[model samples]
Target: MPELPEGKVTQGIAIATAAAFFLLWIAGWLDVASLKGGFIPARVSGLVQVPGAVPVWLTPLSATLVHAGLLHIGFNLLMFVFVGRFVESVIGGGASLILYIVGAYAAALLHWSMDPTSTVPMVGASGAISATFGAYALFFGRDRTRGIGPLSGYAVRVLWLASAWIFVQALIGMAALGGVQVAIFAHIGGFVAGLALARPLLLWRYRKA
Candidate 1:
């Protein structure tokens, strides 16, 4: 668990995810001017031939890699770097990968169920990252992990930050008041999945002690 090399930290899972997202985005750009890009949507932007028009299974998977812009991917990657590593280390790389996949798909499915006709091409990994937070809560909730640097003491000293996080998401989902349109249901779905899946794992750990 030593700190990974600077060049290789995000190489395997994170880089792959980022690469796939960008590659699809390039293809999308080639298809249309200012109208194309396969990124997941915070809101419903009906322009492309989304998986929504095709099949249900594709919705969740497709949404994870899609992004709205460079900034969008940046934010997702930022979350992935900071929180993803902890979850990955705990669950093991394979299980962490599976969790992200499940979280993304679950979020997308929830979104689709809520708004089937809305044409917004879903994009970004926020939902999946949210899942990481959820799992982190269940896994490390006993001790408040402290934070350093710019955000400093603001982030690290909370025992139930995860609950607060969920509450904020609920508010966002219910109101949609945020200037940017977000798939709030997806966030909820991912959070729920993370908590549910992690519960058994946590319980088993306690039993082993």
Candidate 2:
């Protein structure tokens, strides 16, 4: 098991996110929020119009605040709080927050790429949480890859993990076509962002220390 972070931002985020979903659940406004706050690729792409929907630019973060079901929010929060603590602990709260915000946008971009015409709204924090997962795996997971060609051992490992993650997301994305509403590409993009940015953020954090 890993140690907890000195900061409480991660926990607070988890609580706030969970609370947002629960409040919607209790008030039976889940569908309402989904329509208003959820990320709709079509709307951004100018292919669809839905009244009361948030501005295209804001949907990424707004979508993260809503969820489809109890199990959905439950699993997403579980993954988030678990890896988030360790990642935030090492990276510090400010960096963690920046990572999450970037992850949300990255996730939204990938989700949009997958289907530019999709009007089906995507809601949840899985994409954002996946960024934390990527960082956690990089920061904590044991590495086995050695330096290859001009790539350092760490770079090689990052590519390997990213490739594997993309492959998995591809499978999930293909399987979900015309069926479920999972933002598989969002997960992929967020994870890649995390893996790629973790090192830079860490260096920046400790540069003066």
Q: Count the backbone clashes (under 3 Å) in each candidate.
A: 13, 0
Off by over 4 Å in 2: 170-180
lDDT of 1 by residue, 1-209 (tens): 45732323333656876887678667875223122333333334343353324243454665555666676678778777766676655655556666777788777767767766665565667777777767876666666455666553424443245467768887876775434577777787777677766655545445646
Q: State the TM-score for model 2.
A: 0.92
TM-score of each: 0.66, 0.92
lDDT of 2 at 146: 95
Report, for every candidate in turn, its global Cα lDDT versus the true structure.
0.62, 0.88
**Best model per lDDT:** 2
Model 2 worst lDDT run, 10 consecutive residues: 1-10
Point out where model 1 deviates above 4 Å. 1-11, 24-56, 143-163, 170-179, 201-209
Give per-residue CA lDDT, model 2, range 1-209, as digits (tens): 55656548788888889889989999999999998999999999998888877888999998999988877888888888888989988898999998899999999998899899988899999889889889999998885789999998988899999888888877877786345566778999899989988988999899999
